[model samples]
Target: MTVKVFLATATVALGLMAVPAFAEEAPAPAVTPANAAAPPSAADLLFEQPQMRNAAPGSTITYDYLRRSGIAKGPFGAPLQDTVTLKVEKPTVAEKGGAGTPSADARDIAVTMFSGLNRVPAGPFEDMTGNPIVSLFFENHLRALAKVLEANPRYLKLAIRRGLRERAAVTPVKVKVGDREVDGWQVVTRPFAGDPMTERMRGLDDLTYTVVTSPAVPGEIVSMEAASRSKDGGELLQEKLNYDPKAG
Candidate 1:
C-alpha cells in the first residue's frame, strides 16, 4: 500500500519533547552511531538520554501530541490530538535484588496514551518510557517520510542520523517551568540540506527539525517539532510534541 494509505490505516507511534541544560557548563553528548564507544552526540542525548533516571517508581510524565498537514497539497489529512503518558514502575524482585540486579536508577517504563479517534497505539513506544519519547517521534516521522518519498528508510534514517550528529546546532535558551525560568538548550538540524537528491524530495529537502531540553525538568524534553512548507507557504506538514507542565 502507498504510504499515505498505510498511514491512514496502520498504527504507528510518535513522541517528542524539548528543554535544555546550559551548553557552557555541559554540552550535549558528542557520541553518535559512528562511535558507539564514545560519548553521545546531540542526537544521542536527545533520543537516548536517561530522562527518567531521577523519577521515582510510580511517577509519570505526560506530553501533548499534535499532527497536522495543511489543506493545500498537504501530505496528511485531519488533525490528530492525544495525550501520552510515561509511567515508571519498580523493577521486579529478581531485577531488584539478585545478582542480575540492575543499576541504581533502573526502573520499568511504559506508556499510556489517549489518542481519541486517531487509534494509534504506542506499539514499540509502549515500552520506551525510560528514555525520552522523541526517539519514537522521529522514528515514525522518518518512516512516513521514506514511504512518502519512496526512498529507503534505512538510507534516510542514516542520513538524518549523520546530520543530527554532524550538523545540528546546540544553543542555550531559557524555558518557563511553573513561575520560574530554567536554563535550556535548543537544538536545530536540517538533515536534508546536503542531500544530493534534494530535487526529488518535493520541497522537503529543507525541512527543519528542532528539540529543546533542560535538566531542571522532571523529563528533560521541553518540546520537539519537525516541519516543512512549500516555497509559497501554501502546503505544509507539521508534527510536534510539547511537555504539558500543568498535566505533569
Candidate 2:
C-alpha cells in the first residue's frame, strides 16, 4: 500500500498528535545522535513506541471491551460489552514503502480490528500499516464522546494532545498475565479537567484516561480506560478495554 493511504487512515483514527504517531509516517529505525534528548515521556512510550512490532506475526491478541455512556442528565444510553481482537498478519505482498514512507512500526504487519459486522469504519486499510487498534480506539472514543457532549471534536482532541504532551504522568507498575506478574507502565492524564470550556462538558470535564502497557503482552497494551463521573458521583460514563490472556 502507498504511504499516502496509510496516513489518511491514521488521520481519521486519532485525529490528534503528540509525536505525530498513531504510528503514522513511522520511519525506519536510526541511530541516536550525540546531542540526544532526555528519557522518553509517557506520551512518547504510548504514542511513538513500535507497540505492534512486539506482536508475533500470525498471532492474535484479544481485549475485553466495555463502552458505557449513561449520564443521568446526559445524551447517552447503556453500555456495550464485547471482545475485540487484533490479528497480526504478515505482509503477503510487497508494500511500496521505500521513500516518503511514514512510520514503519508494524509496517509489515496488518491487523483486523473487529471479529464481526461492527458499525465502526472499515478502511480499505487492508494494505495500511501501523497499529490499527490504537487508531481504532481513539477514533471511536473521540467521536462518541463528542456526540455525547455535543461538543466540538477538535476541542477534545486538543485537550488530549496538550494533556499528554505536557501533563501526563507515567509510572512503572506490574500487571497479571495468567499466573505470572509482568512489568508494565501506567500513563495517566486528565485532559478535560480545568478546561476553559468546562461548562460545555456537562460534567464530563474530569474525564481521566489511563493506559497500561507491558512488553510481555502480545500487543503491548495491557489495558485502557477513559472515565468521568458527576460531582456527587451520580452520573457516570466509562470506556475501558483490557487484554484477555485466555484469548491470546
Worst 10 residues of 1 by lDDT: 1-10
lDDT of 2 by residue, 119-145 (tens): 454342443334556656766787888
Question: Whole-model lDDT for model 1 versus the true structure?
Answer: 0.60
Q: Write the per-residue lDDT of candidate 1 for residues 1-248, one digit (tens) a residue.
A: 00111111111111111122111111122211121133335755575566656667777877777766553333454556677787766656453455565555555667665555654465322223245366557776776677666776766776667667788877766776556677767778888896877767766777788877777766678777887776666435667777776764
The superposed Cα distance between candidate 2 and the true structure at residue 116, in angstroms, equals 5.5
What is the RMSD, in Å, between candidate 2 and the native fold over all Cα?
Answer: 10.1
Candidate 1 Cα errors over 4 Å, as ranges: 1-41, 71-74, 96-99, 113-117, 123-132
- What's model 1's TM-score? 0.74
TM-score of each model, paired residue for residue: 0.74, 0.75
List residue ranges in candidate 2 displaced over 4 A.
1-39, 92-118, 123-130
